[model samples]
Target: MHSSTLFITLTTALGLVSAAPTDKTYNPTKTSAASRTTHTVIAGRGGRLIFDPDNVVAEVGSIVEFHFNPLNHSVVESSFDTPCQPKDADSFFSGFFPVREGQSDEVFQIEVKDTRPIWFYCAQNNNAHCQSGMTGVINQNFDRQEFSLRAHKELAAEVEGPSGVQGGIQGGWRIPNPNPLGGF
Candidate 1:
């Protein structure tokens, strides 16, 4: 059962990753032709990618991406702001589950029309990163939506967490490294 979930997760990742890291900047997104690709962020490697720009607006054929940092997480396109519990098994998100961690899963190329509102969250308890607001937008195209995202921050205000974790940083239960690595 574990391997099966991993397989489905890997299949979902390949569907989002783009060719290369497009222009990494704010105020102005990549206008190049290859910008159609996107990176779907997930848990693993480290923490996770927070809303650096906090929010972004994309056109019809824009490609976004999500990468794993130093945390164990997944970008499940379903609902439930929690983790593992997939609820968007409908037509759009069904069979489109891609998650990666510890290693590269797959690349997910955006194939939606305009305004793709994908809600992703980390399924890590004891750390409860998502409950602490670890979500962002890919190629969302709307003014009102940007304003709506503001709630994600307050959404976790009641969450008993964030002792040593930063806002954009990942916060989840993890085993301490027995061996100390020289460098990060």
Candidate 2:
């Protein structure tokens, strides 16, 4: 009888131990990467007239939120080789979001598809904007210092016009006065 009771107790204990959850079974961070994440970027700020962080590294499921300042500005996708010209296929334009004084705010959100590097510039009416080195990059493979040097050296011509391809912003994203008479 004693031997039987001891065996039963040992078997129950073993069953409970085997059913217990393991410490490594659940990892929030591993699964959280696919969860949506928002990253903010200033189109132009502090009178410097540049993307606050001209270079960014975004994961596959991240969103890049661009906030335009008081100054008239726009975000248009371009390529590294052709820094100024818009690559029609991969192009996205945020039109020219002019926030009036005392107005709320407008943001352009772009979702990341992959690790491919994305280059953009301000395609304002005045060509000087892009020429003045108003360019930004996302998911950049190279270092920030190296990307900036390349942006300054490469960005020469301004885009002929915005490609009229509006991307980055999902359907839920609303823009105040979205379709201006002659804007993207």
Candidate 3:
């Protein structure tokens, strides 16, 4: 009887241990590269002076890749207060991509460092591209009605001239287009 009771107790303890739930907590800091999402934003697609999906909501560790279309265009970081201008020296800029025939062979990729709204615009001023509503935002907080892409565009429209850094910055990578031929 004593041996049976001991065996039953051991079996019950084992069962309880097996029934415990496993830990599946999500930690953003430890996210793997494979788990990160890459969002594609087409710049000047079909000769239009606009970013296809002008606004995107990206999380930390995610990537925003900009593919430049024909007639020369660029991506430059800017602030909400001063739209159509470079935010600061540390801001990211993809040098002008002059694609005359087809999409450029290179693509600008920037990783989302935080959840803050990142505003950007094309530096081309031929016909006032930035002022023509060539602006976009990432992770814009819709709750803040005062600060939005629409407001940014309004401010950009008021700016006399939109400018960018002299060259590319360190926050992003200008890599060869993964699908140059527009393939999957």
lDDT (CA) per prediction: 0.41, 0.66, 0.86
Arranged by TM-score with the best first, the candidates are 3, 2, 1
Instruction: Tell me each candidate's TM-score.
Output: 0.43, 0.63, 0.78
Q: Quote model 2's TM-score.
A: 0.63
Best candidate, lDDT = 3
lDDT of 3: 0.86
Candidate ranking (lDDT, best to worst): 3, 2, 1
Q: Compose the digit string of candidate 3's lDDT tens values, residues 76-167.
A: 99999988778898899998898877889999999999899999999886428898999999999999979989999998888874365546
Per-candidate clashes, comma-separated: 38, 2, 0
Top TM-score hit = 3
Worst 10 residues of 2 by lDDT: 175-184
